[model samples]
Target chain A: MVEEKEQIRIGIAEGAILATPGTLMTAGLGSCVGLVIYDDSRLLAGMVHIMLPESPHGRPSHPQKYADTGIAWLYETLMEHGASHAHLRAKYAGGSQMFQALQMEALRIGERNVRAVSMQLERLRIPVLGADVGGNVGRTVWFELPSRHYLIRTARGDERQM
Target chain B: MRRLQVDPVTLDALREFGNIGAGHAATALSTLLGGRVKMSVTDARLCPFSEIVDVVGGGETIVAAVFIRIFGTISGNMFVLMSLPSADRLLERLLERLLPAPRKAQEYTELEQSAIAEVGNILSGAYVAAISDLCGISLNQSIPAVAIDMAAALLDIGLMMSGDEENQAILISTSLVHDGNNIDAYFFLLPDLDGTEVLLDILRGKIRHG
Candidate 1:
């Protein structure tokens, strides 16, 4: 019997993680999406902490700063760590419109980002198996490594999966 | 009991000042947000710290706040806060095309520090320019430092309005509108005896111009 004592923690703010098994957590999702990818066979999982859907071109404000750059960074990092693209799957959480001062249409950055991610994932041939997205309230998400199960909590309560 | 007060005349002048400042900010913000990111200068008041409304950012949140320290006339601080929600919106617009996650805006990483700092820089500079032109004073606007909580935001506000604030410090607020969210920009300028006189003179000039 082997016991894995080297559990690592991924703090979500604009960062990435790749672990064969570890706890990746991000708290407070408000119109921001948390991306999680897991490769079952390898027991490898990675998450990207993104604040926006796109980071723009030419002038990437902070390559790891926005969703556009952050997500790209996550994948590349995962690839570097030995995860096969074919076995990867994703789960996302958080995308809410809370402010009443912004235009309903203008505030759709969250939705737009979600769309962008879906397209990117599709292009990468990675399937999205589960997600808890879009709401008026903020949430916290924890992706349990090795298990590929997503634990989510909100002001309302806690969700066991997805 | 005419014990020095800010009346309709003062409020109007301040409001007008806000209007002009906001107009300038609108142009700058629009350029960045990819279109006209709506903005409005809500209310202005002359009071002490006790009168200022306070907000708290959960410890988990990292707030990007920019503070510009102004010398001469009104020696105080001017700040622009993304107010978490607004920050999220701004980042979403800033990075909608590069990543593969649900379109929702979520999860912030340390990678955002510089970007948020730059934003703080832009807003603080823009605000100082507006105020300087309006007051017609050549004041310096310092680069903003990123802060973690609402208390930090208020403390920044406190610095300028501090000192024998035995009396209340005036509060001038601007609400920047974007994607249905309101970003609160607080401007706190405390006039030393000299600053008071200068502010009054500027107020007089604005009235004359109007």
Candidate 2:
């Protein structure tokens, strides 16, 4: 794993990152929220690309695709690599209205997912240090290890430390 | 009941519309990648939101990459989906980099998500704009967001169909043409037939009045 010097691209219906020192980077988030959680102490970080805000009432498929499930998975995975609540910090980015034809409940998937991720983070008390959430701008987020900073880049070339 | 009807005329219009939009997206993509790679536009399908399960899912819930949004008072869910190979190819082309296929995949990195979101933004933005221009309707596009997972999560049919005959859904299954693999883009139009017809009327008015 140490010699794995490679950059991975996470596509639609996908997510990827390198938490081990220099093996991590990714982006392209819209409507779907991207959550970057890392344990600085352990030098571990994970990027979660979620589409929907919640799991369906009856069943949940593609646990990695929903904020509720992906956040939990990220927490578990991060903690497995030596992360604690105190050392655990989460940053959020993306959640936009790309489609201009749906309103009310039908068109609020972005807001809904952001709310859900926020709630889950609160429940875990992980202390979300920053967020660039809820807007009509598609974003690209990068979780750099060692520095443990979440770099946010939007579609319109807006970059910031979120 | 009366979900989206992909009649021959409407189907051709939608396909042409998708083609124009996807072409614009390809232009943006080419500039970003420094390569002239294009995503060809394909056919269109109209689904009754309720049947999205089979449309988006099979034995295993396929990965559904979605860009969620709202335009005016309509529910605009832009979805990109395919089997695993389809997803990989799209990502590879978009990244213009070497992305390892972790045998067991977990999460999308922020860059990857953003890049994909960028892809969604380009395509959807061009799409909505074309629709608005052709239909002569105004649309306020939100930023592009993305999620990857099973087809169900991508489509979220449950929410669309939770109501009775009144608040149903009309899904427009549109395909884009490309070399490597087939990628399907779902334009899950709002369920209310009334709005769609009104929208069509607006489109008609554009050609008629203009």
Candidate 3:
């Protein structure tokens, strides 16, 4: 009997980390950041689907909903799973201006989310290897643990690897 | 992320408002297609933000979505979403008004996209106008934005319009079906937490004054 590669699904405002011989996937990223971090040497990858830049009103009940907390949580989780912090590299997609008709700054949540995620990663000294973001489209993201590559597919059926 | 639980009274008020709004929207849609359009408010409630993805058939359900951002005394988002097949049916009926013998199956063209946006604009306007008249409060809406994508992706755009801390959405969902359910569509009106509270307070005030 042969075992199949396991694929774990991460929903919005959630985070997950997986080691080699598996896949981590998240779908429908719009005005949200799908942050993926990997430690090549350790063959460990983590993904966080962050919905907002910050939790301003009060203490956030879900850590994965905010970029700051979510990225921090993902970083810590990877470390706990034997991933070396020094070998961590990041990539992300999403933060699109979905409502191109709306010119208000408030509607630019996608851009804000990307900026927040970047800032948080920088604070942890993690370098972002690549990103496919912005524009007026949504994307689905997947991280392959074996190759440590990121796959981003747009709503228009355009796919890119980073 | 403490989920806000709206009081039952507020939920009832929102449902009533949604019923009236959905009726106007359906009438507007019927007028557009020059055909009888039946829209039903199946359920209206304050839903946890986390579960909306599942309600709309998960993250990858291909859908046509129209968004209208509302501002003024209260601010939120209004959306019209349907499966691609449903959108195709609606678009065909809509385009037939401008063209003779429109094809039933094909990729959506730029002209069809514009027509869909216009239809969405009219329907959303009717819905918002009804709410404004009932509440006696002014509401301003943005030009309609259209997209074809996964339901979760499209819904994320609406969720972003709400405040970041909002954990719950007043999901006033309406379904429009055609020809014994060959075409099925969903309409959603989501008001942010603060906006929901304000709307309920205004309704309470109106009731007391009346």
By TM-score, the best candidate is 3
Better of 2 and 3 by lDDT: 3
Number of clashing residue pairs in every model?
Answer: 34, 45, 2
Candidate 3 lDDT for residue A129: 98
Query: Given candidate 1, what's the lDDT at residue A155?
Result: 46
**Model 1 lDDT tens row, B135-182:** 777677545544423222223223223333234444556676766656
* Deviation (Å) of B4 in candidate 2: 5.0
Best by lDDT: 3
Best by DockQ: 3
TM, every model: 0.47, 0.49, 0.84
Off by over 4 Å in 2: A1-162, B3-6, B57-60, B73-75, B102-105, B161-194, B204-210
* Per-residue alpha-carbon lDDT of candidate 2 for residues B1-210, written as tens digits (9 for 90 to 100): 445444566555655566666667667766765655556655444454435556655312535354545456443445444444555666676666656764222345767766666766766677677776677566666666565544433443233323222333334444444444455555444423255555554544554455
| Residue B161 of model 2, lDDT score | 27
lDDT of 2 by residue, A127-147 (tens): 888888876555666666677
For model 2 the local lDDT of residue A123 reads 91
- Which ten residues in a row are the worst by lDDT in model 3 chain B? B97-106
In candidate 3, list every pair of residues with a backbone clash: A60-B1, A61-B1
